[model samples]
Target: MDTEEKSNQLELETALNNQTLYWQANLKLLVKLLVVWFAVSFGCGIILVDWLDQFTIAGFKLGFWFAQQGAIYVFVALIFVYARQMKILDRQFDVGDDDSNQEPQS
Candidate 1:
């Protein structure tokens, strides 16, 4: 292949590789967050209610806290955390707000 075409191909390959890596990282982050979510929601709320109820925060029981407000708060926090982390990941992978990072073939 000619120099210009070969250069273009190389650039495309680099961006695609970075994109794949970015997705994998994002998936890992999502899985971690979900696991934590489940732990707080189900593990605390249902599985360990008797143990958690011993320490009441405010008037509500601890397990009730996990089921009612804690899980919701944690979910909101997770949303923002995921967004912030992905933005950092984007920059780390050289996938910033630049057209060159997009697929070159289309």
Candidate 2:
């Protein structure tokens, strides 16, 4: 009932809301990245291989390329994508390390 108590409660609620938003953003990013990985690894490499085989790239069948190398390439690229996204998220959430940005005191 005291003003001080109410202010503390509001601050706590705001912090909780921010934390929740950060988590939701993180989960969404994870799910999107996973979907991309799955699509590249499973869909292109296996499910659509036959259909994709109809195309060729520099004497290599598209499906064979997807199965043997394309998926791995995509996976590596996805790793970079995830890292970049997480870095952005970390900054947005104010969770990123700040020591590197601080000036040393004399």
Candidate 3:
């Protein structure tokens, strides 16, 4: 291949590699967040209910709280956490919004 063609090919490979890495990181974050959500919602709310019920929080059984309110609260928190983390990830991967790159108005 000519020098220019080889350069373009190298750039394409680098871009593909970066895209793969970005997706891997995104999936890793998603899986971790989902695990935390599952652990709190299912594990604490169901499987460990008996064990957690032994404790009280604000006069409510811990397990009951998880089953009733805690899971919803945790899910909401996770939404915000996901947004924030994705923002950071986008910035790290150079995939964030680029207003400056937009075409100028006619």
Candidate 4:
């Protein structure tokens, strides 16, 4: 093949591979969000608060915090954190869109 033809083929292959990578990164981030969601909302919020309250992190009340504000703050922080982490993950996969910082739709 001519050099130009080879270059075009290579570019096409790269684009298709990039799309596959984007979807993989998207899937991974989605799974991570779900697990963290369950852990915070269900684990801390409902199942383990009483037992967790037996101990405190920095003397902050555990169960009350879960019921009141702590879990919410963690959830909000996770949103930003996941946004940041997803950017890294997208770059790592070499599939980041121009807006890589934006998290993918679940």
* Candidate No. with top lDDT: 3
Residue range 1-106, candidate 4, lDDT tens digits: 6999999999788877877877887788889887988887788878988987887766666876786777788789888988898777767765557674443532
The candidate 1 region of ten consecutive residues with least summed lDDT is 97-106
Candidate with maximal TM-score: 3
If ranked by lDDT, best first, what sequence of candidates would result? 3, 1, 2, 4
**Candidate 3 — number of clashing residue pairs?**
0
Which stretch of 10 consecutive residues in model 4 shows the poorest summed lDDT? 97-106
Question: Candidate 1 vs candidate 3: which has greater TM-score?
Answer: 3
> Each prediction's Cα lDDT score?
0.85, 0.85, 0.88, 0.77
lDDT of 2 at 94: 70
Runs in model 4 deviating more than 4 A are 1-10, 56-61, 89-106
lDDT of 2 by residue, 1-106 (tens): 6999999999778877877998999899989999999898799999999999999998888988999999999899988998899888777867665675432322
Give the TM-score (vs. native) of candidate 1. 0.78
Of 2 and 4, the candidate ahead on lDDT is 2
Who is ahead in lDDT, 2 or 3? 3
* TM-score per model over all chains: 0.78, 0.85, 0.88, 0.63
lDDT per residue (tens digit) for residues 3-102 in model 1: 9999999988987898899999989999999998899888988898879988889998998899888988988998899889987897788666657565
What is the TM-score of candidate 4? 0.63
Model 4 deviation from the true structure expressed as Cα RMSD, one decimal place = 5.4
lDDT, residue 59, model 4: 62
lDDT of 3 by residue, 4-102 (tens): 999999977887787799899999999999999999989999999999999999999999999999999999999999999988887787766757433
